[model samples]
Target: MAQDIITIFHGPQHPGITGNMSVELDLLGETIKRAETHVGYLHRGFEKMIERRTVLQAFTIVCRICVPEPDPNEENFARGVEELMGLEVPEKAKWLRTMVLEMARLQAQMLWFAGQGGSLGHYISPQWAVADRDLILDLFEELTGGRVYHMYITPGGVRRDLPEGFLGRLGHFLDYLESRLPEYDNMLLRNPVFLERARGVGIIDPATAREYGVVGPNLRACGFMNDIRKDEPYEMYGEVDFIVPTETSGDVYGRAMVRRAEIEQSISILRQIIRRMPAEKEIMAVLPKNHRKWEVPKGDTLVKTESARGEYSYYMVGDGTDKLRRVQVKGPSAVHAITLLEEMLVDSQLSDVAMIMNSLGTNPPEIER
Candidate 1:
């Protein structure tokens, strides 16, 4: 008698799967034999849509590139435009941008902590992480008037200056987060259940990681030190002092550990920004007489930033028109979700699919885009 092979789709709607993406699996019993990634379940044609819109109009769409970490998208688009226009951001504006980026990292990591717990059938951390994450969202609301999409970081500089006494409130939030770090460790990071499940699952060797274009905490988990902020300093990153955390395991646990350490690094960097921010009245640069009529010079440029998941990059082209000639978004998810995920999923048990995907931080919108 011949053995049976079962075919299944692991979540476009499955809670185990992240976002709105699915994996087609060929399974022998509970073990996945072959896996294929399927995206495009959410928004699509982001690059093509960007090509048709004015520079200002296109700005709104890039934030949707990575729903969990939109500031990196904004930073990349703004910096790419600035490079093409020969624009110089004020020193204070750069610090503000840096602060915004770090906040995004912290919040994204918090959500990941929740997802990691939920993936392993632990409900406690998810609730705690989400509530803590909301505090960060509250700070964002006070700063940008929006909780999810701030649209605060713009081309030449920030959309506006910081509100009165905002830094003090931000400082308080950081202190509270620092105090809660111990709780995170006790509840999740140090939990024996998480350790048993995550320690050896989803191992990606360092060479294969690089070959597949892996970046961010996933790559760092393999014990390779490759951070755009450290290797290629941008904005205020060169000015501030921080460390890139890495792990040797290259498994789910390693990735989790790297992100946890990163949360602390982000907090430290945030404190440095608060201490050394420049005192300047000018935040945003003077736009042209007609903002919509402003055109970028005829040239193309690329910009990259370190987001919580990995490196986020954007390529832009201009034909001396108010509308962009082209805009390309290359987020970490493009590689992690499809190429990396499919490769890692082979021979993996069905139970580990969601845990591994969440560990890799694959966002479906980024894959579809």
Candidate 2:
């Protein structure tokens, strides 16, 4: 039996790999007997780097913690600092931040469509979904000079007020995205081949989800309807109306369905923001005369937000100095890419490794950081 087992590495470079990470698997023929996650290539010591930087400086780099969905990182870091400093964010700023988060969620979901579909050999999904996701990125570029980093969200509030006519454009885009969801459903969700492949694949036991610290859609797939927006009500989330979708299967199909349903919910949340947000108001809270010289009283706070994948959290500490005493990021992928990935990969066929990883929404950058 020992002779029958063969070990293989499944990439930091392979096309099927989620990111700059690899999975080492021991296989008996095509079935995996053991699996281990490997990560390091993308690490930049972000938490340590933030400790040496001022609050505003740290804001600029938090987005780099998670590439596929960066807004949640910015949100957690900013909110944590705000809590520590006793800074009051403007009401309008809360609405704007909420809008940004929802947009990021929708864009991330679109990117996930590409990854999940590509993993299952559905090329059409990537082609269409990536292109649509670009449309959202275009908006991001307009809002923040940088498309990917988007240091637009700072500790006090947003960097600037909404650009003239930004709301009108966003409304039209939301309408377009709403119309496109049905097409995505027909293309992937309802496809019999995809359905059959995903139905029972990478099944995660409901009992283990919480133990493994699973969050977001993966946890929701287990029929646990926990969402920071609904449960914690940060920013303007409490003011909006949206559903938290859930499924009982706790399998690849269930996770896929949860995300697919969530796209519509994000769209609905964005619509509510557009309708209820104040027409004119301040976007940023008061800042010190010297931004770099700003200091927070000695305190620590943990901020949590629901990212596209799961719960994204940041632990921040200040020592009554301009620089942070410590900053720690607990990305959702930390659990999914390691514990859940390794456990689920065992007994799985080689053909389903990518499928399982995608279903779990493993983003390596977060793990390595």
Candidate 3:
């Protein structure tokens, strides 16, 4: 006799889900037999929207591509436009952009910690991680006037220069964040309960990771030394010093550990930026005198940035017009949240669904966009 197969949706409303996305699962005795990804709950049609707007107008909307980590979208958009226009960004602006990217990465990892812990019924991790993450948000709010979506990075460079004594405040926060790392390790990384649930589960074969278009920490977790920052240095990444951490296990715990190590790396990068940043007052490049009728040269260029989740890219075209001829985004979530996720869910227990999703750093808005 064959067992009855049960069909169910894992979310668009469930707390365990990473975002406004659902996975349809065909299950038998709590083990997933098949999985299908469903998106469109959040914002959509971002590429179309960008194509219809002017360069400046389009800049405002790219940040909406990924809510948790918007800076990468902004960076990609800015760099793509800059390349098309042949604009040279100032040295100071480059360091500022790099700092913002690293700050974004740090906060995003904290959010991941919250999701990873919450999915496994470890409530303490969320509370502690969120509280610590808020410190970075506070710095963002001070720097960019927005906590979540910072529309700070622009076409040629950053929107403005840093405020007075801002680096001093940032340095202090970095110290605080570094000091709290041990506490995070004790509560989550070293906790026996977390180890039992995470170890050896949701393992991704290193050989298959690349074939599935895996990037960022997920790829690194599988022992690949791939990182956009190192491979293709942008902004001030070429000037900074950092290592791409990796793990051979390719499991939930290995992914978690990679992120843990990256938090320290982000801190180190920020410290280097703070020390070596050029002392220049000019942050923005000169734009056309007429803002409403600004036109770029006829050309297209591709730009990529290493976001918190993975590699984010923008392909932009200009036909000598005020509006862009085309704008296309290739975010990591499109692959990770849909195809890779569906494949990983098969034959896995239902309870581990959210844990697996969170480990991949799945974000639905990126998928929908």
TM-score of each predicted structure versus truth: 0.98, 0.97, 0.98
Candidate 2's error at 112, in angstroms?
Answer: 0.5
For residue 233, what is the lDDT in candidate 3?
96
TM-score of 1: 0.98
Candidate 3 lDDT tens digits, 1-369? 899998999888765545688899999999999999988998678888887888899899999988888899999989988898889998888889999999999999999999999999899989998898999998999889998989999998898778889999999999999999999999999999989999999898887898988999899999999999999999989988999999989999999999999999999999998898788798989888666676888998889899878999788888998888888888888888888889989999999999999989999888777
- Per-residue lDDT tens digits for candidate 1, residues 1-369, read 767998999888755444798899999989899999887788689988988888788888889888888899999999999989888888889999999999999999999988999988999988999899999999999888899999989888998788898898999999999999999999999999988888899999999998988999999999999999999999999999999999999999999999999999999999999899777888887678676777899999888999999998787898898888988888898999888888899998999988999999978887777
Candidate lDDT scores, in order, read: 0.90, 0.88, 0.90
- Off-target runs (Cα >4 Å) in candidate 1 are 16-18
Off by over 4 Å in 2: 1-3, 16-18
Instruction: Report how far residue 178 has shifted in candidate 3, in Å.
Output: 0.6
Instruction: Show the lowest summed lDDT stretch of 10 residues, model 1.
Output: 10-19
Cα deviation of 55 in candidate 2 (Å)?
1.2
